[model samples]
Target: MVVENHVPLQRLNTFGIAARAMRLARVRSDADVLALVRHPDWRWQDTFILGGGSNIVLTGDVRALVLKVEIPGRRLVHEDARGWLVEAGAGERWHDFVAWTLQQGWPGLENLALIPGTVGAAPVQNIGAYGVELQDRFHSLDAIDLETGAPLTLRHEHCAFGYRDSVFKHERPHAGGMGLKGRALITRVRFWLPKRWRVELGYHDLQRKVAETGITEPSPQQVFDWVCQIRRAKLPDPAVLGNAGSFFKNPTVTPEQCADIIGRDPHVVHYPMPDGSVKLAAGWLIDACGWKGKTVGRAGVYEKQALVLVNLGGPTNPCTGGEVMTLARLIQTSVYERFGIRLEPEPVVVG
Candidate 1:
């Protein structure tokens, strides 16, 4: 129930951006949040919920009250012949949770290994990798409304999950008009891991691992290990070089659009979706635009992967959020000019 002032945010965010939260509170449980909501002096103030800080960009000092979620726990909620329902606190690290599930004989989350951030942040971004999205294994979640401190439970349908999207990402409601955004604070999340586990090697990286290893029937642990290896080889560790995993979502286009791009550059990397749409590789586009290994104002495109944008200056003298966004906008402008499609940023911007 302690509220602190002038909290340093450099260590909190994976990007290592130098910023300060005017006021910050660490909420380890639902009760802690309720206690804060009932506090006389801070009851009506605007609050920002922070998870692992993996999916955000800090442009400047955060003026609002920051609730740094630190809740913790993991348990099997229910089990049946079909699947096992597991619950984890919002603050649990996502990659560790995935590994823990595998050790406990739950094979469903292995493909999502090595992803940075907290469990609560996963649903916000609908985090996905290697063809498995959080929505695929999600059961339900419990959250506390910041305004009233009232507990709320939402099922999978209530989340309104989409490609790297959820109700949590939208500040304003869409057609259904039920956006949660910054209004609710997730405390716990439950996942449905099926007993009849089938390995997901749909992504090109996983397929390459299988081919390279010559292991046709890879176990869950093997898949998890492979994912970590691939990510390590391709992505720069945040601890060494500050970065937020992928900078942009893979843009989807119609068949005609794909054909048009192919006509212009036949080597363009793209994938055909089940829904008849084409998913164009954002990295390939950025690399094709000659941004890879290039730096703009201390913000640079990763040499190994163009999708990732990194802070060239590191923690000592990190790039400003303004520099990162400037580079992002420049890349977006170039891609749009070349492909006639806009690339949207994946991280949430905080100021």
Candidate 2:
């Protein structure tokens, strides 16, 4: 119920962008959100929900009342022969939750280990990695309707999950679907980890780990460890180098489009989808454009992985969100000009 003014946000966001929130509140429970919505002085429509701050780019000082979700808890809600239903608070760290599930003998989320952001934010972005997505294990979620202060429990169908997308990502209703965007604040999420656990090593990196370790039938913990190792090696730790993980989502194209791109550059990395579409690696395109280890202002493309954009200026002199976007625009333009595919940024850009 307490709102603070002029909160520093440099460390809150993984990108380490220098910004401030005009008004901020830490949401710890359902009651906290309800109280804020019913507050006569505060308008619910003027609020913004923020979670782990791992997947956002703050363009400037935030004028909206920032609800920094800090709700916490994790427990086994139910169990049956089919699966285990696990629930976690919206604010729980995603990686920690994934590890906790594995330790509890629930193995469905091992491949999603080491991803940034909170559990609540996971569904919002439909976060995926190593061939496993949140939607694969998602059961349901509890959220507060910011407009009416009513509690809501939404299932997978209600979320409309897609590749790095969900109904929560849209601010306006489109295609006969109502968008929750700014009108909802997730409080808790439940996941169903099936008893029939199966390892997902379809990603090239995981396959390589299986090959190198000679552990073809790796356990969940081993998969978790390998994923953590692979991520640590490929991504810059936010604590050390400011970044928002992969800057762009891999673009999916039709078979003909893929063939055209292949004809242009025979070595373009891509994967065929079950739906008959082809997903091109965004990093390879950027690297092929010769952007690796390059910089624009204080923003640079990670030399090891071109999909990631980094803040070259350390904490003492951080890169502004403007600089980051500038670099992203340049990268997008380059890739589009070369391959005729438009690259879309994955992070939610907020000003």
Candidate 3:
């Protein structure tokens, strides 16, 4: 575990924001993490755990000791008549792992295909797509406590997964006063894929695809391919156009609030939740407020999908985190002013 100095992080993050890590260490195993935590010189230093760097915005040079997780492995740990239990190292690419699971006949994660980032980061954000959240198939995860230098295995209930949130997203003082943000380093993640799998085509795009292709009962690989195609067309490729996928979480509102907004604007897009609340389409709100194709200092709302904020300038002149935040705040203000619902950013912001 060699600690490097002043590592450029422009390519590391999906936003392509120019920044540097003051001190960075690549951790490839549990021993490397233990060694870092047990080291007297580095034990007390502030540290940031980095996975694939797809869900973060670097505002400035990172001052914390950056632990870049590189642990790599994938295997079917257990299989029975009921389902399959698959385990993967935290550093494994999420999309590749999903594809691998499909190839192995573990067909549950097809809806979440094509998402950027590492498997370790999935639980932190409770990443979801097309009505399938990680918690739905999560079995357990192993992580190391940064403060105590002890290992922990957490189950579904222990994670406290919510909409785009988990215990990992908050600090100790927050999250019901027991949050684990920055306090745990995930080593491995295990998924529970049922043997009797069912395809999830609840999203509008997937339904549209089914209508266009006339495939009523699609296989897991077909679903995966469809999701990939939809995402590729809607969201800009991070390699070509720097972005962090969806920029905002779809804000949920009470039924009364939804009715009020509907009364004001009849064309408002919303979905009724199981709990009687209404989930407003944030992208629709932004587009309604005329934000698509808008730019603010090299940062702009994606033309294809208003939910995505992209870097207008290429790698030669990338958008700074400040500019991205500025555009975000402006959109938030507009959406709140127009719809009376405040938009929340989805990505983690750090410096």
Counted clashes in each candidate structure: 0, 0, 0
lDDT against true structure, model 3: 0.94
- TM-score for each candidate, following the candidate numbering: 0.98, 0.98, 0.98
Compared with the true structure, the alpha-carbon lDDT of candidate 1 equals: 0.93
Looking at model 1, report the run of 10 residues with the lowest lDDT sum: 169-178
Query: How would you encode candidate 1's per-residue C-alpha lDDT over 1-351 as one tens digit per residue?
Result: 999999999999999999999999999988899999899988898889999999889999999999999999999999999999999999999999998998899889988999999998999999999888999999999999888988999998899999999998777884485788889899999999999989898889889988998998999999999999999999999999999999999999999999999999999999899899999999999999999999888899999999999999988899999999999999999999988989999999999
For candidate 3, the clash count comes to 0
lDDT of 3 by residue, 1-351 (tens): 689999999988998999999999999999999999999988999999999889899899999999999899999999999999999999999999999999988899999999999999999999999989999999999999988889999898888899999989888644454689999999999999998988888778999999999999999999999999999999999999999999999999999999999999999889888899999889999999999999999999999999999999889999999999999999999998988899999999998
| Better candidate number, 2 or 3, judged by lDDT | 3
Per-model C-alpha RMSD:
0.9, 0.9, 1.1
Residue 1, candidate 3: how far off, in angstroms?
Answer: 1.7
Task: Give the TM-score comparing model 1 with the true structure, all chains together.
Answer: 0.98
Q: Which TM-score value belongs to model 2?
A: 0.98
Model 2, global lDDT: 0.93
After superposition, candidate 1 runs with Cα above 4 Å error: 175-177
